[model samples]
Target chain A: MTVPAEAARRRIVDLFLSSEERLLQRWTQLSGASPGELRDLYQALRTALSSEDGDFADVRGLLAELSRARVRQGHTPSDTARLVFSLKEALYEVAEADGGPEALRGFVWFSRLVDDLGLYTFESYTAAREKIIIDQTEQLLELSTPVVKLWEGIVAVPLVGTLDSARTQVVMEKLLQTLVDTGSEHAVIDITGVPAVDTQVAQHLLKTVVAARLMGAECVISGIRPQIAHTIVTLGIEFGDIVTKASLADALSYALSRSGVEITGAARTRVAVRAERA
Target chain B: MERVPILKLGDILIVSIQIDLDDQSVLALQEDLADMVVSSGARGVIIDITAVEIVDSFIGRMFSTIAAMTRMLDAETVVVGMRPAVAITLVELGLSLGGVRTALNLEKGVAMLEHVRGAAG
Candidate 1:
């Protein structure tokens, strides 16, 4: 196959050799270095880079093939994860060096690779890498377009998608930082916004709530859709063990209730009765 | 850069924010997003960054302002799709994001709005 565009091809050769040498050494230590495995890794690298035929599908298909090939060839799940990670780590410098969206386009293949592996292998490592890109991309725009600082009470943050360690760390930090700055006593994360539920993401949600709670701001999760609930159940993710709700409103209402704030409409009678006793 | 309205997700509206939010754009866009939120009766707002690169402090402050106003209006706001280096730089610079809500992506921000809509008034 024709080599990648001049710059990308150069990057591949420069980075791939060190990685290959390391992989060969590792393999040699693990068993005996087979020339075929070494050659296969080289081809795998080439295939991954070459798959981008000015058409996006090429790299994606290559990732799928490499994942299966890695597994069938007895490369541990972690091995494949590292392969993806190293590619990113290598490209991370490339993007930083080049500094443009064009630089980031190469990453799409890696992103697709993460999705491909995340679905097939069901590994946390792959998920974490995906979160890195997502988090970075999310951080680019000021989501606070309609920004506000609450002088008091709770403001909810709904977290969705796979909350890998990198993302979980950001989620916990940003939410707590917001609560502190706003002086809000409650920060709710409604999972109903989440399209998928896995044990890792669920735990990160739990951790976020716990972190908020530690700051004296109670965290409430709402919007547990039926499908998400089922996935949580199958995945053995236990929200019953943590503080969560079925919907964002419930979570907000729960927060309001916890803060001793009464919604004046339906609870007017109860408020009157309590006032009378007081 | 010119700003364009793309899609609506409940009270949360997505704006394809054009031009990097620098000092000048931040001033205008703050008023722009706030007015839109109020007029649209959106409980939340997301500034899509698929095209943006840099978010200087002046613009960062605008985000904080919009977030504060949205809270006053009883709505939430989320900033979506920032680059990694941008995030790192913002954090390292001891940036003042104020009380703005941040989401990982557009879909999550929209989904968060549903929770806000469903809650008891």
Candidate 2:
């Protein structure tokens, strides 16, 4: 609320009122923003400078919206900030043209206000960018862990990428929920897409299996690559009695057999006769 | 202290815990379940905890103790209808409820007991 001397305020307001159009035009050209966007900011800045308390709330609000829009448009933070700083240059030209020590002094106070506003715009831009990144990360977490129903009374979680505690928690919750929803007695955790299997990852897997067992569902871990098997043996990580298979296909057949599903091959000659008739 | 009721369905003894399990009720229920299993000669015991929202380490241990006790009495114990949150909490607490069978619901629990008894017979 530092009302830079009454005389300086009056001088700036008078200059703004007399040449508002010219100042806005110059600001648009320098900032490379549309005239429509510059017009709202110009009016708010003029009102703020002329007000008794010298409040810049309206100006800051406009800048925040501008920065958020610029962030969505993929503009850099500095680029959004430069739009506000360029106004100082536009106003300086008008103040210098008016001529006199008073106008020059008033320009200094105006430049300080614009500096604060420019920094405010930079902060807003970064805040908006951070919000976008957080939303995307949440979406990726949900996208990565999907509980798919492989067959009647059978569910599978195809885990991909590195297994972290947070991702494992999501997978565990989703798998358990699906088990209850479908009333499936068996779940197969397919880790074919998982890159590595460290002790921590093994611990998470064991915890998940234990949790599912507590809920009365059997879990079969599949897709153990040769190198992962060696690492697991070297690490002395015991999967205990929990069944594991080398591939997803092996796991599926195992689950089917355990569920009492007899998968007999269809007659090939009957299929060929049907195809020939078609 | 509220005593947990045990309903006998043929050879299987069903105990559905619908209230918050304090220490006193848990101990009383364990004693009662043991006595019922002996007197009734139930072949299977199913403890349904679908309504239980919270469980401490003590309550978690009760499950293991009950399973062991029932087994000693010539009965198989199946903890059924355990809420997902309770299951996760028990796992986090490192109480795997080992040696105790579990099923998704009451119908499944009965089916599992039948399957076990049939296999054993």
Candidate 3:
């Protein structure tokens, strides 16, 4: 590199090594980070600056770890970046006290390095946050699709939320698997919790029904709210001979009757008569 | 070349496919099934595929082809015991096997055939 820049780098490394403890103390006080967190980062920074190639790999590694910890602690991205940037202020205080033209030049070089490290921390923080979001989304997908047995020969999938291609795929796979496991001939897909039903969603529903039929089970879609029925009719989407019921109760009874279950009201009336006599 | 065995249970013919179906085997099974239906005068046919794992377009069409052949011979064909993955693959491949009937298992398949017979009578 240029001769003056090389001299400036060396002068900064010397400053870091001379008063490492005091610089770390100032960093902790300025950044409001725990002393233990700042100490490891300070040592890594010193080692990186003193190295022949000035490779800041160790400093970056330490910053990434710090970023991950701050992310877990729910700290903001700026807060994590400021922790790295504050080290520059601590170093500047030392450089100013050890004043020389070379120290001033060295402070400029160090400031640029810290700026790069600060941005690196920000990048690491964002990456960690993205991982958390992806993990939560996967969990939510699993949680939302549940296949429950409604009767001896029937099962129901109570679907909630907006139906997307990915979520529909999960629901389809899970429903089909449950059908095979339960050997239930009837499945009622209850979409009461679904907010909307566009053509794409209707298509997914049709595919699921077709898949289940291929597995030798009949699917009855329930929870067709008034608005969704209007939308479906407006879109000219024909549910084609597949049964659509207005409520889960209707869907369940439809499934039961299809399976040859005769639900008589005699038992309910008997209980009602006993209550009246008492 | 492995041959899929076709068993006669009363008036119903049962073909349980337990082997991976290559083109040759599939074609052989189709020919053998058609012959058995005609010779035995079976009223119904149940093709059980619970033990089968994969089905491509050829094997899928083989199902429809067999169903149509049996129907022409005055026998009803009901495919039964299809695995979920296989069913989903068939659907995604756009081979719904529309003309053929399906039941969840062997018992259900037999029950469905009886129900159809009872209704027809």
Candidate 4:
């Protein structure tokens, strides 16, 4: 270490260790660390400063731990960075009191070191937050793609939101698995929950239908509102031989009819109407 | 040599494949099924594969071939009770068993075959 840096480091540590109450007060005012945590943080900071060139593994390791800790504690980037910058205030007080010609250069080097540490903490905080967001998105995709058994020979998947490739894969897998497990020949893909049907969404639906056919199951796509039907026609997207319905009820009825199961409810209604006429 | 049994139920030919069908067995079953359809004058063919866990490209092709041959002989083929994993694997393998009808279970498969026969007559 340089002569001035070593001297400045020792003086900074003394100021930090001697006036522990004042440092703790400043830390508490800036963030949410308890007295016990402030003690460990200050102790680690002291050890980090004594290390050569501030590029030591100990310093890097401590900054990473602190960054993650700050994120978990719901601390903002500025709040976490402020934790490191606060130490500089303490160092500056001691540096000014020293009143030596080299004190200025030493304080400047110390300030630069603190700035680097503060930025590192901020970087780690953002990275942790991004990972959290990605995990939540995966969970949401799983929740949205649900396979439901509609009848003895029919199962249905009601898809909602955007149908990205990853979500489509999940939907296809779940739908196909239910088809096999239930031994259902017909699968109704109810896209009523789906807000819009773009070309890409149509393509995903087509791929899923083809995959179901490969499993020896017939796929019926349902929930085509007027707008979606128009969009599909305007885009000139052909669903080929796949059966599509305007509603889940229509698809279910089609599936039931294909399976040759008669809905007695309709027959009863007709019989009741005939009885009333008689 | 392993063999998958082909049983006759009324005018319907029921082939319940309880074992994992190898290439030889699959071929034998196909030949036996085609012969049975012609000799018995069956109206419908139901191949129940409820125990089947895998359907590779070869088995997939065999299914389509059987359906086509039976249809040629004036009999409808319905494959039933395919497990989800097998379906997924078949789909991923890019095998869409066209011209082959499927039902969820033995009862449904039989019902589907009978329905087609009923519709035709």
On lDDT, the leading prediction is 3
Question: Model 3: per-residue lDDT, tens digit, A90-169?
Answer: 99999999898788898898898889999999999999999999999899899988899998879999988788888888
Q: Residue A186's C-alpha lDDT in candidate 3?
A: 93
Candidate 3 off by > 4 Å? A2-4, A50-58, A107-109, A160-165, A265-278, B1-20, B36-43, B51-54, B118-121
Best by DockQ: 3
Candidate 3 chain B minimal-lDDT segment of 10 residues? B89-98
* Candidate 3 local Cα displacement, residue A112, angstroms: 3.9
User: Can you write out model 4's per-residue Cα lDDT over A118-210, one digit (the tens) per residue?
Assistant: 888888889888888999988988788788888777889888876777787778778877776767779999988777777877776787787
lDDT of 1 by residue, A157-183 (tens): 666555455565566567666665565
Q: Which ten residues in a row have the lowest lDDT in candidate 3 chain A?
A: A269-278
Show pairs that collide, candidate 2: none
- Cα deviation of A40, candidate 4, in Å: 2.8
Cα DockQ of the candidate 3 complex: 0.77
Docking class of 1: incorrect
DockQ of each candidate relative to the true complex: 0.02, 0.71, 0.77, 0.37
Interface RMSD per candidate: 10.3, 0.8, 0.8, 2.8
What TM value does the first chain of each candidate achieve?
Answer: 0.43, 0.84, 0.88, 0.81
* Candidate 4 error regions (>4 Å): A1-22, A26-36, A47-75, A101-103, A161-165, A264-278, B1-121
Please provide, for model 2 over B10-107, each residue's C-alpha lDDT reduced to its tens digit, 9 standing for 90 to 100: 99999999998889999999999999999998999999988889878888889899999999998999988887778888888878777888999888
Number of the candidate with higher lDDT, 2 or 4: 2
* Cα-based lDDT at residue A185, candidate 2: 88
